[model samples]
Target: MEKIKPRNFFDRMQALDRRYIYLVVALSIILPLIIPFNSKTYVTEPTENVYKKIDSYAGRKDRAILMCFSHDASTMAELFPMEVAILRHCFERKIPVFTICFMPAAKPLMDYAIMTAKEDYNVQSGIDYLSFGYKPYGLFLPILLGMGDDISEAVETDDQGRKIDSLPIMKEIRNYNEMNLVIDFAASAAVYSWIIYARAKFGVNVAAGITAVMAADNYPYLQTGQLTGMLSGLKGAAEYEKLVDIFATHRDENGNIASREFSKEILKETWIKLSDIQDRRYKTARIGMNAQTVAHVMIIVFILLGNVGYFVTRKKDIEPTG
Candidate 1:
């Protein structure tokens, strides 16, 4: 009978060094960031619903989209991309976008998204878009209620201290009737306030853009129609980006744009006219999706290998001796 080596291949795998797995994972994540790969993302119902709602308001001057930034830097990694996607959609379709931040820390992020998303486009402040800046949380509820009556009085000035009522965009946007859609982005459960106060009182449709970990908590609102739709975390952001790319930019997958017929129907129904227009900027969430996918795959591979080693080694130990 052949003798087994003191440290056989199976034994080595059973006791594999943790450092090796760590190195593999690190490389798996880093390589995707370095390499530009075309990854397809599946659009979920919740994310698609948000896109559909925004698309429904395309080229409409009467109804505008209000983006509420209620999160700080801690959740920016997941939520910021969502902001950019929503902004790009609005900009592409020429929908007037209004932004407000209640949390002081969220003010900068609000500015960052506007500044970043407006770079390639000719979007100007007080004209195409407006930011209400940082309002105290204590006063936000009152301001929310007041906006239903008079937006200019509620948000007295833009972030730059300019009179909001004096802006070109504000002339048509008086209250929730004009600015109908409200999408709240938060790390915590800030959408509840928007639901209870903004939707409950004013009768405006509400939606949420949140991190995946916090997604489950908001599903109840989504189901009840309190939230018209939601974008849940990075995956949601990526899906929105894909939809934008497919509709506005005419980005095709290997020259096959009609691979997803559902998206085509959405484009037709939304009446988004495709032109030679292209967004030359890097799609952050799509790129980040690559890294996330690779990391997850690597972890699953490691887990499977560990399990195989455990089971194989156990079989050897359990064999009867002559």
Candidate 2:
């Protein structure tokens, strides 16, 4: 039999500072973003549901789909990954995406996201996809949708100063009439603008990607089938990452590695590659459990140490004022 004593001096000496734990948490998130993790995480049923919705409305080579980026730089960190994942799948499936933005400031965001996926997925611009650049429609998009006219006349050239009509992708896309799906990734209410114009007037099918906070705002639309489907925030992004077969070293909402440490509780394990079900379940269930795990463990240790110090001080205080 083996006897155990309290944590030894050497063991205590080896303990990590809570600040170090914070660094690990920060690095776990930032490191992946800074470098190309390119993990192969599998998508879930709900994520697949969005793809199925996209496919349901997609067809005809000239009929390009539109992706509206309504979120600004603040959300780029959380939303961009989901943007890339969506763009990757769409382009890989040979879907031509016409990127649009309702916010002038968001155009760069649209461009950054579009260009990254285009480069990474080998998606060619002016053919496979485009940035309709930014348009200042104000509230008239619904009127333009009904008109089925080129909104490009409003912004003559793209961000690069190239005449949009000259771009090959734009050559096929004139107005909402030429679009099949409107995939709006938003952090604002600009999503409703698409609903009015793209769906109501143009009769185009709609899909969306938004932060989890904005997600519930879209549910009634989902129920009414006004929006075909949506991916809600980073959790949604992780799910999409799985379907597209990209995995990184970071963990999910739970402390689990963004993928299965081993092959257990996975369906289609032989065929479906990258992330497995069990890996995402805990994180998704607990909501930032991984982020909290490293923090909470350290807090508990500090509290225990604080209690020990308090007890020792109490003994001295009872003996004398000194």
Candidate 3:
């Protein structure tokens, strides 16, 4: 039998179409999962600044967090982790959450979020948080939120067919004026609706978790102090996971690995990373890594290969084809 080995390290690393780099990246993340590598997370100065300010207003009896989903399946890759972690934190602390959807389809998505939150933390449904389904009317959103008792009076059932009045969580939440914090997970400029009607009109505190593409625009809101805190895409969610010591995906009760449920008070430190969250965020509809990130890497790879491929082919061309 002939022994085979590459003469050089570069040759050894060459991968035709095997996606060995992806395997390596996957292992870099997955090994940590199996071994439980412990690394203390650094509080990004941005999150710290937001944390101190957000922490100040927490723990109020009626203080609530309103998280909005203004996106479709395509944007979920970057948006869901941040949304889930923020929701977990709010529910764990017994903070009331009134999640809604400006995009309308977000209504079902929001319900899925609530169900996961409840199952993960064993949270009480109405007492802990409530998703008001996808209210189809964007124009009335402002009035529904800021119009006080009028909003609650009109909203009869929650997304799950529960009577809004019967919910212990909603029994007293009469208006947007009572909301302590508003966390908007947005994609396009659609979230501005909540900004104009909910926060500006009622003076409710606001925060946000937005996709990387849309995050730049929201910085103005942060600068204006219209938003108390914000998480920009998957990186922000990973940072938040480090803050709370949980993973987006975790081991199941039977020891089979699975996506971690959202729990405000997570007992076991989870393996929640932006990558893991992406798995759940897209769920049945995901493909691969972040497209932009992938493109950047491909660009670099191609640049190196171009230089090498050019030299190799040129050498062959210069030499006579005998």
Better of 1 and 2 by TM-score: 1
- The order of the candidates by lDDT, greatest first, is 1, 2, 3
lDDT of 2 by residue, 94-116 (tens): 66776767677787888777766
Q: What are the runs in model 1 whose C-alpha is more than 4 Å off?
A: 1-20, 251-281, 305-322
From the highest TM-score down, the ranking of the candidates is 1, 3, 2
Q: Is candidate 1 or candidate 3 better by lDDT?
A: 1
Expressed as tens digits, the lDDT of each residue in 223-315 for candidate 3 is 887777777766666566555434333456795544333343453343334445433432211122333344446667856875776666556
**lDDT for each candidate structure:** 0.82, 0.62, 0.59
Q: TM-score: which is higher, 1 or 3? A: 1
Would you list the clashing residue pairs of candidate 3? 88-264, 92-264, 247-270, 247-271, 247-272, 248-272
